[model samples]
Target: MSASDNKIVNQENKNSADIITWREYEALRNEMRREFRTNDDELKSTVDEIKQTLDATNVTVTGLSDQMTDIQRNIADMRLAIENLTVLQQQQQEDDDDPELEDDAHNARGAPRGHRPRGWVPLGRNGRGQDEEDGLGKPKFSIPKFEGGADVEEYLTWELKIEKLWSLHPHYSEDRKIKLASSEFDGYALRWWDSLVRNLDEDGAQPIRTWRAMKEAMTSRFVPTNYMRNIFDKLTLLRQGVKTVDEYYMEMEMLMQRGRVRESLEMTMQRFLNGLKYDVKGIVRHYTYTNMNQLLHHAREAESQLAEEAKVKGRATGAGRFTPRSFYSAGAFDALHSLLYSA
Candidate 1:
């Protein structure tokens, strides 16, 4: 009873210890597996969030890039518009010479006979009086006339009078007047005469033969053609080299200073005109500005009027408010301003 009973009790104690150890191990393993599952789910969620952020960032970058491209395109277009306007202005300047030819042609006809010539001469024979015949008889060209009472009759009487005056004037030698008229009108005689009505209206002159006389008087007052040609050459050179408005302004300012002329605010404006001319000749083919031409014309008028006023006043009057030179400067300022401020 003593030895056998003690051995059995020891064995039972060992068996109980082994069973408890096995249960503890199983519980620890289950806890570890649950923790790993939680960590894995957290990692997947973090990765998905990062991917979403990356996609959003890409979309934003792409949109910004597209907007930048559009802005660049607009800038190019504006540049082109400015360039085309310049070329048009140059063409107009060249055409200014044509009007002189018309004056010479009018003078060459000599005195109008007190009566119409024999052939195709309507001596009030077309059932109209002399005045009415004069109105209807000359080759009727449908042309624009002044808004006032300057119709066909008025124009015909004026033309006849001018011819008579040309014949009588001390300076008008028959041959010289003919040559001068021919040289002045050249290819543009009829067209120049047609344009005279508008010119007269603008200048506040009455539509009469005296209009031609006034023009001839003015032409005589100008410096020779060669002097103007030299001015044109220099202007053209300066216009072509300037890339930016600022550069152009500086050059013009220098010119004014050298000429001993007070720097006009209109100089700034002239720079703008030059910029437009440059843009027209250089950039217009590549880019388009719808109103560039009109802007250029306005600038030109402002410059011309300012210059005239300066001449009349005996000094620079508008210099403080708008420097005549300012016209030239405005072109560059506008270009840069557009580039910076535009959306």
Candidate 2:
């Protein structure tokens, strides 16, 4: 009986111990699973936060890049503008250094050389004149037919007809006409016959006022003093005769030598006549007036003496005694007469 009881008790104790150990192992496994789940959740949260921070940093970098691009564009534009301004300034400086450019700019701006562009009409050789061209390339005024018979009487008759026609106009006063005629004749003083005649044809009884206006207009067209004197001499001859022309020309030369006539006239008839001769044909005519025959002879003698003096002195002759640079060649005079006298 004692051996059976001992065996049963020992078996029961062993069975109880095994049951307790199994229970403890199950509890520990459950706790470890819970702890692993908590740790995984925390790691996921930290990873999410880091990802958000990275995204924000990327956006900031992108924005900074865009701002840099805009700044670069602005800098480039400023550079281009500065370069253009620099080029323009350089070109202006270059133009300032050039006299021809200055002249061209002045002409383009409608500033005259000595006189205003309005009062004096530019004439060409062959009786052609230049007028201001309109935008359509047509001249502002047409050239008038001024050539008539070569007879002085015929010219005078035409002039009288024009004078009479002018008289009919309300703007033309008889007193003014008489005064102008007298002034023209007197101004010519038997020297500037051709100039006188031409002026009469163009201006008639308004020589003083018209010529003065022309001169005023020509203020921008400044010419050399010697050139002015030559013009005055030429104009005097046109108005009067060669004798007066020579006298005036000589007087002007003397004045120039004495420095008395420096900058006397800003513009002169000779310059106008030269321009006309170069531009217009038939504007200036050469003829040996019977009244000027003696004067011409004396001028020839004086010219000869001047030439001889020049040869002896081994220097250039005075302009008055020398052949005219612009007009008054023997051949030119003969040609003019032929053209005038030709039927």
Candidate 3:
């Protein structure tokens, strides 16, 4: 082969190699572009998913915020309720502790200044009429007024009524009990209480805080010194006379109570027996009795038996059926005889 032919072949070979390398480079560039486009598309898809996740997170955060706000409001309302309940309990405690009748919002607690509350007879010093309801809008139990009187029995009855009032409604404090009792006073009784209070205040003496003290003061003022002596004298001189056993017993019992007598059961029984009529006392003395009740029972039975015997005797003699004409005078008898004949 000639050197020139060889050179031409080498050149052709080089050219062919060059062309193959160029084609391979172009293919590689195209592959790289396609890969880049695919990567870009995948990145864009990831970005869209991230944006959707962010939007969902925002919605969740908003919902959680609203729930937190509601929880806070509920907590606030619970706190308010607790505060109100505490206040109510405190108020109730105050009402129960106070002793004096002071004015409050409700009528049940007390009366207005210097006046009696509902259901109680007011002092009427302020010229107010009786009230039906107490401070708390509840009806009060009616208590009778106590006007001072000279009769010891009347005062005792009034005092007994006052005691009964306390027993029925026992929640009163010591001071309140005294105040309530005084509130029922009217006329002379009211004046007496006012004077007592004023005198004590002026003398710088301790106020009457107890019912016992008030009762003592009242007894001293209303009851005469010789009242008990008079009652005792009447009791000592008592006799059954023409009265029945029950009537005699009642009179003796009243005298004892009025004089506040205290004696042994035996002595009391004997005293009661001694007061009975001769026949009744004779029978009762012979009976076996341990107490006054037994003695009285025996006495009453004896009296009843005697009465029955008398009634039988009168019937047997026709004395129970006697007419007025039997006792008429001679002149009266003639008038009746003439009138009957004429008729």
Whose TM-score is greatest here?
Answer: 3
Summarize candidate 3's per-residue lDDT along 1-343 as a digit string, tens digits.
Answer: 9999999999999998776577889999999999999999999999999999999999999999999999998997797688656644543444445333333324533555766455444322322222312212122566678889777777978777888877876654455567677777899999989998999989967678678899889888888879878888999999999998889889998888767789999888888888888888887777898987888889889998899999999788895565776757446778879999999
Q: Give the CA lDDT, 0 to 100, for residue 322 in model 2.
A: 54
Instruction: Give per-residue CA lDDT, model 2, range 125-181, as digits (tens).
Output: 322123211101122222222233333333334344444544553332333333333
lDDT of each: 0.49, 0.47, 0.75
How many residue pairs clash in model 2? 45
Per-residue accuracy of model 1 over 1-343 as CA lDDT, tens digit each: 7999999999999998777576788898999999999998999999999999999999999999999999998887786666545533432342234343234333433437563333322324432223222222222222222222323333334334445545554333332333333333322344555476578879956443333554454333322455445544555456634344345546654444323244345554444455554434343334333453444445445445545766978655545566636865779767777899995
lDDT of 1 at 19: 74
* Model 1 stretches astray by more than 4 angstroms: 1-20, 96-343
Q: TM-score each candidate.
A: 0.25, 0.27, 0.51
Q: Per lDDT, what order, best first?
A: 3, 1, 2
TM-score of the candidate numbered 2?
A: 0.27
Task: Give the range of the ten consecutive residues with the poorest summed lDDT in model 3.
Answer: 130-139
Clash number for each model? 43, 45, 8
- Scored by lDDT, the top model is 3
